[model samples]
Target: MRLKIKRSNEQRLITLPDGATVSDLLNEIGSASINIKVGFPPQTIDISDTSKLLTDSGIKNGEMIIVTDTIETEVPVNKNEVAIATVSNQNDAPYVQIDDIFLVLRKIPDDNSCFFNSVGYCIFGPDSIKYPDSQQELRQAVANVIRENNQGIYNSAILGGKSITEYSQWIQSSNSWGGAIEAQILAEYLDISIWTVDIESLQVYKFNDEMASRFCVIMYSGIHYDAMALKLDTSLDEEDSQICVFDKFSELGTLIEDNVLKLTNHLKNQGYYTNTSTFILQCQICLATLQGEKEANSHAKKTGHTNFGEVN
Candidate 1:
């Protein structure tokens, strides 16, 4: 039997035996797709239940299945804008919570440089305006850090089968993807602990777990990464400050330890977690929407409109 798996703007056809289960089809899709991340699982809703066997789910041959590789939500986050969520108060500090606890986060552009931009935003805040170029530099920095320690902690296992030079070149590429590996390298480079939260699994992946006054926490919904910040309540203060600084790790740590799991469960219950990926690529010169990557690349090559952003 054949089924059509629709992912983003692309669709793929997969063949399966007549009695294949949903898990079996998922395995096949995992093997055949390159866009899906390794650790993050793929899901489907063809027959209303994700775990039901295809044969038992009333799925017909050549049925079109909407395959979502990442968590889906209609989260309206723009580049340079912050994401704030209201939660129960868990702390008594001045910036902690006066009324409702808010989880503040910054949205990075949905490009290959998201990890770098996210790290940069956490580090320098609005001062980090370098964007794609800064991301390129940070990639080189990560590669350099690995190359300097190639014979020691950084090895082929860490690089995922690439040599030091090969990995260095790969990271420097504009289209190369970044994730926990890059986050770890950036953490060591900046000497700060980086915490990555997976929205689907509700697991916090920490890098450079040592104590630090200032650190970073990013939200990972499988494919893209976004920076997480704390929205402080400044009603008592005479002046309003948009950005809040953490004096101790315990402040944010306590909140995450106490409320992150509950918040995740709440988000799931509210159906805030979704699996939809749609990026609008506009020409920097004329602001026209390009058809796809090929057309965007062709436009850049012909008209030099290299400055493009993903409007989601």
Candidate 2:
């Protein structure tokens, strides 16, 4: 029997035995380098029920099966904020401040891979042993996602001058940078929503909002990005390993008020957010001066220097 498997912007026909189980079909496709071909991790076949055989699942010869990477998990929702909460009382402005809400920002290295590193940190936390090569893994994963979806979403027009192949190669390059585009792809690939809060503008950029099962909020200064996790309750002992996870922005707004308010304020107090146009940045390592954040970032990338201070 021939089965049509549709996945990641491409569809293929596969031959299988008449009595084969869904598991058997998946196993057959799994070994055929499907993951590599599709540029995603190994996916579990969803025939509504996994235990049923292909024939039992209503799969017939020459029938089509749509493959999807997202598997809905039973995440508990905070009932208090099921409806979208207004961010502000002033005619729905973007930024809002919540009382008693705090976040712990996990700083990633100032390397070009901060976006990837922050994503890794959000997914696996700060344990090096558990996620030793997460940054590299994610970088390659992003490239694969782009490569697999090339003809459609990641085509040349969207990528500017570079072709799909060039963009894919660049995504895996360490020196090549990752930004909002990469973040959106990562969110889709991971089946999560990423809320990127811009410190200076106090603007929130959401990626994969439509199909997100979980939320990973990260702080984005104009020049860099860092992971932000809810600070555990002070009443809880430090030894307690439990952490708070927000499954949706509405839940966060309902629970924490304006989560970005505290984050933006913290960034302001730490001198992370500044008016980059007029800010003077001086390299502490080499004593070289740059006009603004963009120039400083370019200098740092060119010189392999991470130490820099704003010279007011």
Candidate 3:
């Protein structure tokens, strides 16, 4: 049997034995685990049981199968099960139904302050006016939160080797990117919970979940970040993807969390994933293929081959 390997930019083919199980394929690909999708439009086939045969697993000949060394489980997904991996997000519709409510993204501009803009959109409603300056206020707010902290949590180790003062200045610059640490600070500063979901991995990181009953959702892709909103109307007539913070144990909160999880997992299965570990980068200068971002950066530093693109 032959399988297709899909990465960020390139795809490769590998031949497997008739009895090659999921484990055998993983061993062949040099990955500990993998996410399998086969057939046209691609369906997510459970690769949890490594001993299951490919044919029995519903993989067919010459079919397009996306390969990855990762599996994300939000709910307890059973083994050897199959699920439709199609994306329902359309330009006209642009939202999905989660019970009675609708889920949609309030897109944030990618000016390197996407994180700030996204958080701003979450804090203020979807139609907020804080996006113009890329929300420099949030950056300064994050800087102040870190600067004023007496505890050593925002120390150099967490600052990625920069001193607290230096980090504050750097983050205050218009071009800096805000991430987990800043997220935590803002969660504390605003006294609200924040949940950021990675579409690729479908992992949700919750900040200040305990302190506040209010939380906003944000979606992150390889390129940039966006805010998640929930609204009542099915159509995009209403621009508010209403802020979804609620009592964690309450019925509404549970329902919203479940639906958000459902949406993320569906998107992940639909091949909306970015495998940062195995990004296929090619140097435009020497035509050298690099494995990942680390290798690409090192390649640029060593050979001065900075201009690069996807392998395509």
Candidate 4:
């Protein structure tokens, strides 16, 4: 299998046999002996030291890879060790809590929406802040946390059915206005509640009044499709699951059966490529579902099993 590579801002290509793991492919390209960096925003795995990254991240053949040479510099200390050392050095300094709320807000409102595509965002004050590192594993962990905290903001018009671009804007938007508009938009659009957990003060705030004042909007609009889907599912299910549970595959079914003609017609008529394309694609998905259900029912009848309704 051929693998396209972008390393340290340079274009280089490499080839690997089919079914090769990242480690195996690196070996074939004489890069296994060197430190290899992978990931969109740049993350490194010391292939020369640890091959576990490949196995853990499920990196395998025929996939594009980005590898970078290791940068040598000052001696590094483990985070925990550094924290301990800092605490020891400063007698009166208070220790930082692991779950402390660390908010970094920007003040740029006209930021290009594309910036949010790079990360995941959420509404819960404590659950939203992701780690600083971009390591794939850590990023995934942060994504999971955001997913858990974010309940239903995705399906809302705040996202406008454009997940990638919408999120990019959220990430780039500054919190200079205390993120008031962004937070309010998310709350109104997603129709969910947000509460802040102050670890240091042990105070829980229902509204981020200070947050609003410091930034124009507290934006965590960026998110992956999976996270968005999860939020959408939770939101729809809350409104009488028996009638409105919206699964990805069953999206068209829910839309049509629930009589969402106005919304769907507006989307189709508006020529909003993002929503229109997704809706059209969902039609194909629903057709496949109908076919599958038909086959299942046929088999059930032949086997003398009870028939469950399609909705069930």
lDDT of each: 0.57, 0.61, 0.65, 0.30
Put the candidates in TM-score order, highest first.
3, 2, 1, 4
Error of 1 at 298 (Å): 25
The sequence of per-residue lDDT tens digits that candidate 4 reaches over residues 1-312 is 556654433445676545455566566556543445444322445454344445455455444455433322222222232111112221121121111110112111222221121121321111112322222322233233334436554433544233543344333332111222333433333333333222223233333332331111122221101111111121222211111112222433223222222222332343312221112111122232223434543543354332222321
The model with the greater TM-score, 2 or 3, is 3
TM-score of every prediction relative to native? 0.51, 0.56, 0.59, 0.26
Better-scoring candidate (TM-score), 1 or 2: 2
Better of 2 and 4 by TM-score: 2
Off by over 4 Å in 4: 19-24, 27-34, 37-46, 49-57, 73-150, 155-312
The lowest-lDDT stretch of 10 consecutive residues in candidate 1 is 34-43
Better of 2 and 3 by lDDT: 3
Rank order by lDDT, top first? 3, 2, 1, 4
Instruction: Pick the lDDT winner.
Output: 3
Total colliding residue pairs, candidate 3: 3
Candidate 2: how many backbone clashes?
A: 0
In candidate 4, what residue range of length 10 has the lowest lDDT sum? 222-231
Better of 1 and 3 by TM-score: 3
Q: Tens digit of lDDT per residue, candidate 3, span 46-87?
A: 878889987788876665565533422122322223232223
Q: What TM-score would you give candidate 1 relative to the actual structure?
A: 0.51
Model 2 bad stretches (over 4 Å): 1-101, 128-132, 155-157, 235-244, 249-253, 274-312
Query: Which candidate number would show the highest TM-score if scored against the true structure?
Result: 3
